[model samples]
Target: MNVPTVPMLFVEIEGVLRKTPDDLGRPWKGPFDIEVFPDAVERLRLWKGAGGRAIGFSQQGGVALGETDEQTAVRTLWTVRERVANLLDHVVHCPHHPEAAMPDHARCWCRLPKPGMLIAAQHEVSLRQQERYPLWMALLVARSPEALQAASDLGLDHLHGDAWRRDGGQ
Candidate 1:
């Protein structure tokens, strides 16, 4: 058996690259206002400058709950992607939730901790680049135990987001 050696970085968006709306007092809205952490961006800048690729793995469940919609969710992601140049190569967001108000947004295998998002991204990368999985690192926020568990389930190497940043994202 052979393993794929594409060396892609699978990263968590909220709480990792960008500071999320944990203190917003409401579900986040579209046209995302949060700034990507400076050090995080610096790390990614260096990472990409060295010819590495990164993909943001996120779940925009606000669409499911009626706080936002799918288009807005997608736009927000692309908006962020435009902000940071040459860091993230792609973005994958899941708008599903088991308790979604909209029927279509409810229940999916793509939410974090489920591996759907990662698997889909895997296929996407392999298809587009003709190369595949490497030892992906799920750079997760320290507060998210669920993401850590999900990374383990996906059989990828993992690291704490803050620590990774502090370590200069090596």
Candidate 2:
């Protein structure tokens, strides 16, 4: 039997890419100084070299906490995109949290442990590529339990730990 394949990958940002912000709300001031974890760049390269498509997913509730606004968050992500242009195909961010200081920002979808972002990305990717793959067939590379749980809920393949390095020293 012949089987079709989709070379897509979903990766988490916060802990996997950079150190989890000391305070998600006030991680940094002035600009987003993303300190990428060791082997993060390399991992993306290997995955791309193997012909895997990569999409970035991050749960950032900083904006809702009144630390920043949507515009700032987008700008930060834009900077990240510029740096990882060759590796990432696209990025999806969640700026909502249940405990948001801003009432308007509270209680919304797109948070991890919830499949909103993944489902949205899947739909967007399917539309853009003009092809659909079962959610379980997609691969998730990350080190966040929330992202991993979200992957599990969606039945996607998930990998986590030490920037995906063999040694747990990331």
Candidate 3:
């Protein structure tokens, strides 16, 4: 009998960071924040050994309420890296403000709800291994329902609302 190996799970940050209040809403406190639950780390180790890869991640809110776009981007990336360093094969950051007053051309492609980062990661992985899974799933753990839907529209198999409390079951 051939036992089907479980597919690797791609987790997102932001909503998986901590249970904090923000523009969207409150997320469950992730295991990384408290250090009490080893679930996050354990999951990472499993994924790394099994050749799993996280697709993309973005800040929960568009920076703080009044913080500059640059500040928010920097802080968000730093936080994300620190939190998911164990499981993440690669990370991407979107420096543009979703509500910025700039022209559309000025925006970058790393933003959530967009598949640029995921696409890039998938390409990189494929180049390295030359193996393509039947289903290429990209999980987005943001608070914006709109953003989730956008990602879904972009052909991602999974779009998670929040990663903190999410259980990507086998």
Candidate 4:
């Protein structure tokens, strides 16, 4: 019997920031700085080398309203992506508002509390690699327990909080 290799390491963006803005709604106003999770990155590399894949990643902070083009979001995520290219096979983002009153944003599947992004990534990877290998497991990384619980309720694989260090201090 062959053991199936699955994706590992889900890095949460935004909330992991070393600095927090007074207003969460508007974070791009000032010069924002973010710290990378070195330990998580290392783990990701190992998983990738072992034929593991990154099924899901979420941006807990920063609200991106409306159906903005993917380019805009990709640019914002590029910074995070650069740190874990080897670990990450794909990225999923929620560019919608959580509340219904926010018509400009509206309800969408990409949101964190929802598993649409993860599900989509899973399908993408399965289709992309089905000819070569089988998918056994998937992981989700969120900034809060709420997000993790939500992912679990949605049938997502192991969900974890945002905390990454090269030395595995946490």
Candidate 5:
């Protein structure tokens, strides 16, 4: 991967790459079943084919809420990655919720509303490859206002989930 020249795409798994929402607007209760949006795989393919590195990120507070365990939550991430043809370069999720029942998950930096996960991804890429990626060369693809806020905080370019999928994450 041309880590320096190509841009980075930070994708939100729920409501963007996958169809986990039901009619009530709540995500699937648990991570047992996984489903990818119809065009997500092709869109990701095009994004990667264009030399853009992709990272999957999400807010899996279910772990903190006692709805699921850390292992199960991570397993869902893997399932989504495989369903998308294994195109993602990295995947991260914030299992913490501010009012989480689990004390360990009550506070965290990598949560969606926070830019920690985004920063971690960029920082890791920079360190591992000894290459830097300017904020302009990165894009956060998601629909949530919280996610957009996080992108803005990091000065990373961003696009709505619909627009990105339509434009192949351009």
Candidate 6:
């Protein structure tokens, strides 16, 4: 019997794996604000146990809002990564905001709805590694419409929370 190669899982960090801060109370300044959703973590574990890799895709617009910096954003993601340990393979974030005052974090294509980060991840985790998984078999677990659309454009299967939408909001 031939076992199929497991596909990679693309997860949205904020909102899906962790709750976004309701108020601007020291957001992403430290690891204190990080909270890993138990449900999401469990699901991620299942994927990992199945020989799959999981990558986090987050749109960290707080850097543009002046609430945080690239380092802070990375630290926060690392905190979450520590929680899940081996279950999570990598985490990528976008710091761009269209209206950001800082040019460094402004108007980058890597932001959600553009597919830059996802494309980067795709290249980073070579598709050839997962021999049994094709582009359409790659899975994305995110609640954001932009992520859903990006996955759709990339010909991937997407799940929003617990609901699986194959049509991809076409």
CA lDDT of every candidate: 0.71, 0.72, 0.49, 0.53, 0.82, 0.74
> Between candidates 1 and 3, which one is better according to lDDT?
1
Model 6 residue 99 lDDT?
81
Q: Residue 49, candidate 3: how far off, in angstroms?
A: 3.3
Q: Summing lDDT over every window of 10 consecutive residues in candidate 4, give the lowest-scoring window.
A: 16-25
* Model 6: worst 10 consecutive residues (lDDT sum): 161-170
For 22-119, candidate 2 gives per-residue lDDT tens digits of 72444555345765655776777877788666778877798888877888887766666565654877778999988986766887778888888877
TM-score preference between candidates 2 and 5, better one: 5
Which candidate would rank higher by TM-score, 2 or 3? Answer: 2
lDDT for each residue of candidate 4 in 1-170, tens digit (9 for 90 to 100): 44445544444554542223532434553222434555556756665687666643554324544334556666656656665563466666666666535765666766666666666766776667662223234455555675677657766554344433333223
Candidate 5 runs further than 4 Å off: 1-3, 23-32, 127-130
CA lDDT, candidate 4, residue 5:
51
Residue pairs clashing, model 5: none
| Ranking of all predicted structures according to lDDT, beginning with the best and ending with the worst | 5, 6, 2, 1, 4, 3
TM-score of each prediction: 0.82, 0.80, 0.59, 0.65, 0.86, 0.80
lDDT of 4: 0.53
Q: What are the per-residue Cα lDDT tens digits for candidate 3 across 1-170?
A: 44333243444554443334462364434323322124555555655676555544554334332344555455555555565554555555555556655545236565556666556665675556555533443344445564566557765555353443445333
TM-score of 1: 0.82
Global fold similarity of model 4 (TM-score):
0.65
Show where candidate 4 strays beyond 4 Å.
1-10, 15-34, 60-71, 99-104, 131-136, 157-159, 162-170
Off by over 4 Å in 3: 1-10, 22-38, 59-66, 69-75, 104-110, 124-143, 159-166
Q: Please write out the lDDT profile of model 5 over residues 38-143, one tens digit for every residue.
A: 6878888988898778889989887888878999989999888888999988888888988986677898888877889888976776676666667788888898
Instruction: List pairs with backbone clashes in candidate 2.
Output: none
How many residue pairs clash in all the candidates, one count each? 0, 0, 0, 4, 0, 0
